[model samples]
Target chain A: MGVVVTSPQFKDNARQAMADAPLQRALGHVRKNFIERRAAAAAGLPEFEALRDSARDIKNHTLAHLDLYLEEWERKVLAAGGHVHWARNAAEANRAIVDICKARGAKTVTKGKSMISEEIGLNDALAAAGVAAIETDLGEYIIQLRGEHPSHIIAPAVHLNKDQVESDFRRVHTHLPKERDLAEPTALLAEARAVLRQKFIEADVGITGANFLVAETGSSVIVTNEGNGDLTQTLPKVHVVIASIEKITPTMEDVAQLLRVLARSATGQEMSVYTTFSTGPRRPGDPDGPQEYHVVVLDNGRSSMLGGDFEDMLRCIRCGACMNHCPVYHAVGGHAYGWVYPGPMGSVLTPTLIGVDKAGHLPNASTFCGRCESVCPVRIPLPKMMRHWREREFERNLSPAALRSGLKLWAFFARRPALYRLATRLSTKALHLMGRTKGRFAKMPLASGWTDHRDLAAPQADTFQALWKQRRETR
Target chain B: MTARDDILANIRRARGVAGGEAPRRAAVEERLARAPTGIIPARARGDAAHRLALFRARVEAASASFATVADAAAAPDEIARYLRDANLPATLRMGADPRLAALPWAGTAIEIARGASDGHDLNAVSFAFAGIAETGTLALVSGPDNPTTLNFLPDNHIVLIEAADVVADMETVWARLRERFGKGALPRVLNLVTGPSRSADIEQTLLLGAHGPRRLHVVLVGAGEIGRQD
Candidate 1:
């Protein structure tokens, strides 16, 4: 893979991320912006919850019959004179894309924001094949200039401040006026738009990601607010869509259901500015648009996830709502997760794609506040999936020795209720008496990791079991 | 084995079924043949008048501008007026749509250009196939009639939507599309544009006119009622 897997050092990565001042400032935006906007959008529509359910069911049904849907989609794509390339993994997916681009002798290709492309490391693959891919999404463009992956799926440059963007623009875009006023976000946006517009017109190939692939009509749908996706796909001679197998929907009706919840959950817009459904190459007598249409249908370990514990994860639409609502994500930002995806969804999804041993910390990073599942448009039961991963990690002896011993020690007493109650009662009384003066512990043995960040609240004189028995008997 | 076969085989094996399951195939074919509707929002269940108002409200809320004309003939004047009021150029780009061509642009001083845009035009107008009221979205099909480029490559994109084409929900738009394009088929590009181009990529602050049109103005003709009746 072109991208480095930093998931193994997730703890160290998170520690470094927490210490970065600019990153902390940038992460403040994720907390301040996404949560309120999503809540407002959901509150505005009465059927928002029902729409989420419908979206989930549509994805579930499509996945259950995924083989049929994929075959049907491929047949329709062929019927429409479009090419379908099946990729079993990331390398194959990138191979198909590079071959398509190289066959046309493309020097430069403009790209829309697509997580599938990131997952497959397509840009790195293209570079190796002597092709340059220009990211057209504004957020993607900024991070691309910095030689970084997207911090968030939808908001790629959410971890960047305007000042940082200003410097990046000044540093990279030297041909522009050196004294250009780019202190404001608007000026930076104008510059990027001007620069990318020429690339859009000049590029030989255009690659995009699909939000939904319709099997009935053999169309690929892309939803974008900046209209960059349209420009990327429409301007080039060849339009290549990179999407996973689970993106397929049964029909346009199902697409509508998903779209209804997508923008609301992601950006709080009633609808994105542009949602384009492309069937095939430019038709006969068409004035503009691409001449060649190709879709790279990738499995990438998703097909193997079916009928498994991670099957619910396949229904995810990549809306980023889970990350937006996640407190851990808000604290560390997406980079700490060390993958294209981050937050609760990544916690479950990352382990499956890259082995559980590598991504073990992602699942354990969650606060288990259940906000992600509550806000998930498809209701993927994120915490439940994370727990499953933890179980898998422990069963394989992947967790630390201390954690395993602690768990085993607790389980030994928990199996015997009398011993467990006595142990808890004695421990709580001893700790409460010791901490009675301060009512909290700033430092403690074996728990300094937790206390270092914040003082640990002292335990009470009695366990919850004893308190519950007393209350029930008195009642 | 080929990648396609391998992937398909893996999925089938995981699901504990061969590709020849008649029931599964039938279910897939049935869903594809009959694209059924899902739970449409109650907000879209209003009358046509309410639909028109909601369409205007939602479209405006999406950061797009619109004006109502008494008839199709009045659209050209309104278009000119909007352009003049907004201080935009008098030149307009469009396709050879007969509906737009039939309008008497000779009465105005506006310069009219024809065919799809090559990214140089500042103002462009395309006729929308449908206007969905649920999210104030405009569905424009790609062909010679309304090139997809015009929908994205202009500074000011002005679309003329007939009152009769306005629908309450996206599901209805699907029905209209199927009726026109036939089942299991679609145009090269069906663009559902709600507002003008915008981006919040830098510091989560929204900026308009990013890589696409800076302004999207809708001219709804015959706006008093839903159908052709005055």
Candidate 2:
């Protein structure tokens, strides 16, 4: 899909999405299904918390020493007979990939599911260069056909329903019978498979994302439920792996720890159906594999995060667990977050990558529910991190002046316990008087955003601070 | 050699501030120290056999194959029979495994190709040194007998299992693997195959044959012996 899924310009698109009742209903169904499935998977494992901690430790340790691991990983990969390239950012990454394809005179490029590639807008770049970039992941292919950005990290088209898919298929596949039935999921799947199989066989360059880079062996681990990742990595003569630099681990044991948590958190599977680890190019006696292997490691604002307070953010394995559990993400989905990554991770990551000016509103989207933090396998304090970003945005003059002024005034009063207590008491009394009977405001002046969709209840006459004072005096 | 050294050097550069490595003996000792000193907690509830059976049932439910064998000695013959039943070629490029040397299957007339060289050969038999009952996974460590290619290249894969090696959970497997190989050692490949190679790439149709083995056969020798042997 195009990169416009939930641009900062998404208020208008979100309004449009809200207006479409059917689309909202479809998203609701999908949200509930994933939420329930994730809960069930988590409930079944007694060691889930322990696993998460271990996974977090592994990731943190790797990221903490990422440079070392990456260098070692590249060495092993090269030793295994693979070539490595470094890209400073998205443009460089895209250029390197396109150049490789051009060098090969590649006409068709098949891709596995890689959010990094999406972040770099690789397909559009390839297409602009007159190369055909086909997304082989079923969900990815569907979104690609619709010319939209992925709405979810793991399930890219989670926002689209069967009917919408049927419509897209019919619109695109003009060669199909005019009276063809697109109602069945199976039928839709069959159609997609038919269309993709031809592309897989004909593709000249295959590109994929690496789940983990093993420093000990120089292997790129790709875990997929569908074998498409294997095809995308092996079928074509040239295989290009576009992965974030943070994906490296020191050893297979470290990879194992991460793998244990990844699938269980993402789709609730003990392990994904396929976990293929490719080491270097095809060996001398090998058969039916890529002849050339190129791994492009993209830094893209990640290196800056090292040894910083946001260092914990690099521990993310892109499992999409935090997004799956986030309430705001469930309501608005990935597009609402407005970047390559979404959910709690996206809220923190997007602002860092694109700068707060472009994503000033993203960090404010959360309700501080703590569910994202609780569910994050890497233990990233996502809510706190977002707040940190918000603070940075304000300090850098990225936030609107009014918001900064209001926050400054609030902080001033909050620091003075007496003034804070007095102000809250007065505000509560005023709110109570405004809604004496209903005890709720329909549209408060300063809280139109909160009251637009739902009512905000007035606080009790006596505040907690006031009650505490009374109790202490009586004692 | 320089490439390897360069990689190590880069790592040293990246880890500019060395987080002092805990002594190897101390690390192991620390773990032991943390172990319960009192009466060990009651053995985790449920029969080991039942847990394994239930796990196998779950794996099958997820569309994977599972088998239990009495020992590694019987792996080759069971694998031979499975390949024969599938009507696959008898000449199998197999992974390197010292255990296969003891399997007296000369009468089976099956040709065995061994080592990493066999990775891309379409027909091969591979032995998982261990199987995780929790996920129905076969852990194939690269050695003389277990070649990395045997796990990745073959269109039809036969994984032999020893009942004694089945672990109840992934954590236990990790602990054991680490204890055996240390932190720095790694096999060329450590394939954890849960099922036959399958893909839903073509419009999510769930095609069984994509890149890896189209069929997976597990030769479970003695269904009742896993818990008892371990």
Candidate 3:
């Protein structure tokens, strides 16, 4: 795997995350802001849902014809005097990028927030090869300063409060006056801006992740609120774009449809401040742009995903809506999923990218509230996919023996309706009689996990089926 | 097989395609050839005057400064006023865009330098290829006429948008682009800038001028009921 997988220990990570005060304080921002802003933005647009359907259709069309589109895009890139390298995995992708920087003798490389770069661990790889990789995105830069992985995909530092960020800056930037009022976000932003401005001008190679790679024009599109991506690609001598195979869109019109929904879904904005469509490098007689343009096309297990049950995941534009509206994500936060990705989308995708065996705990983490699917811009069935992961886990016996045995016992009773009804009726009657004095039980047999947090409500005399039968009989 | 061939083969296998099927090929080719327009919002479907109004309102909403001029010849003066109002440098960097070059820059004392941005210019101007009313976006195509660097390097970016070039939505913008840069080809870069550069990454509090221009002032030229030309 490109990044280390602590996905197997997701339960422990989630437990730790739930108890972390600073992270919990930080997650409150995501919970309050993203939902309201997105709702307001969507409510203001009458065609928002219709546009989502259109965006989904376009992505589906592209993926179905991905082979042809990829071929066309490659041809167009080559025609436009750009270089395209195909990578089977993260290692190859990193190598291709490192070699490009080396060939240019790039001492420093400025980066625009690319999840692909994170997935490939390009920073460490570049550092190993003696190249300084500078993260120009504010969120990425902060996390990079802390030697931490991004929790949220879109807002990488969504896990940190302003105080935490101020401390991080203070710790790293010792040359600055310690007593400078780094209290406000504005002051912090200004500091980062001043710091990164020099790096942007000095870097030899610039790398950015593509939101969409247009097959029609051979353009790699990046949508960002900050203009960091534009400057990163424009000022540098060499520009490198790293994107997964599934990022392809067939045409500009298709891109338009996707872009309409992307910003609204991601950050609840009409459009991100900078939506750049970069074709080749600089043209003849053109001044002040990259001299060389290189695109590293990474497969990294996505091709196999297209043919499977998880193909719907490929339609994702990385808007982070699925995770944003997710109740489980809100509770445990992103780091709990314990990989490059987190939340419902990560649960489904991590299994495919890494493997269900390692990431089996992710799908089990969801509460199936279905908020993720409802807010999904492309209408990806995130919960359904997570269920699929659970099934796969069960099929492969990746689930614990106790869980398997419990399910087996339930299945034994469920196979026979009379036995199931009788068993449930008896249990309910006993519980009702036992807990008549109290409405709930503080502890219950064989269900300590449920009772440890809060008391389970005692069942009434009648089971749900019995109540239904009685109602039907009386009516 | 090479990685590319292997990946394609895998995709083909997963999609249950033989890779040479005529219907699939035709569908793929047709979609690319047609470049079908998708669901454009009702808000973007309005009269010329209405769209211009919407464009101004949206531009302001996105935290960009908007100004209207009577003609292209009035752009430089308007730009000069904007720089002066913002208390920015009188000197500006620009490209060889004839529309911009034709502006009566001599009317103002602002120093004008040509070519592209070297990351030192405090202010830069570029003539937009088109503007989208739905999001108040400036679609700038890269070339010698309007180098891409001028769009990002400066602290204040003053874009000269002809009122006539403002379109209803992004779809129309694409159609216009296809017409300008042939089918399946584009300029080196096409930047769709909505307001100034901003970031919410610092504790998710919105702050402008994170890396790009802190001030994005638009000079809308040639007023009146200017309908879609294409």
lDDT of 3 by residue, A1-475 (tens): 3367899999899889889998898899999888888998899899999998998888888888999999999998999999999999999999999999998888999999999998999999999999999999999999999888899999999999999889999998898998899989989999998889889999999999999998888999999988889889998999999999999999888888888899999999989999999988788888778989999999999998886899999999999988889888888898889899998889999999888999999999888989999999999999999999999999999999999999999999999999999999999999999988998999998889999989999898889999999999999
Model 1 agreement with the true structure over B118-211: per-residue lDDT tens digits: 9899899999999998889999999998888899988999999998899998889888988999888989999999989999999899899999
Question: Fraction of true contacts kept, per model?
Answer: 0.95, 0.16, 0.91
Q: What is each predicted model's overall lDDT from 0 to 1?
A: 0.92, 0.71, 0.89
* Model 2 TM-score, all chains together: 0.79
Regions more than 4 Å wrong, model 3: B224-230
Displacement of residue B81 (Cα, Å) in model 1 is 1.3
Clashing pairs in 1: none
DockQ of each: 0.87, 0.17, 0.81
Which 10 consecutive residues of model 2 chain B have the lowest summed lDDT? B35-44
lDDT of 3 by residue, B1-230 (tens): 98888888998998888888999889988988988888878886878887888888888889998888888877778888888888887999889988778878888999999998778889999989999998889999888899888888889988888888999888888888878888888889989999999998866788898889899998888884333322
- Candidate 2 chain A worst ten-residue window by lDDT: A1-10
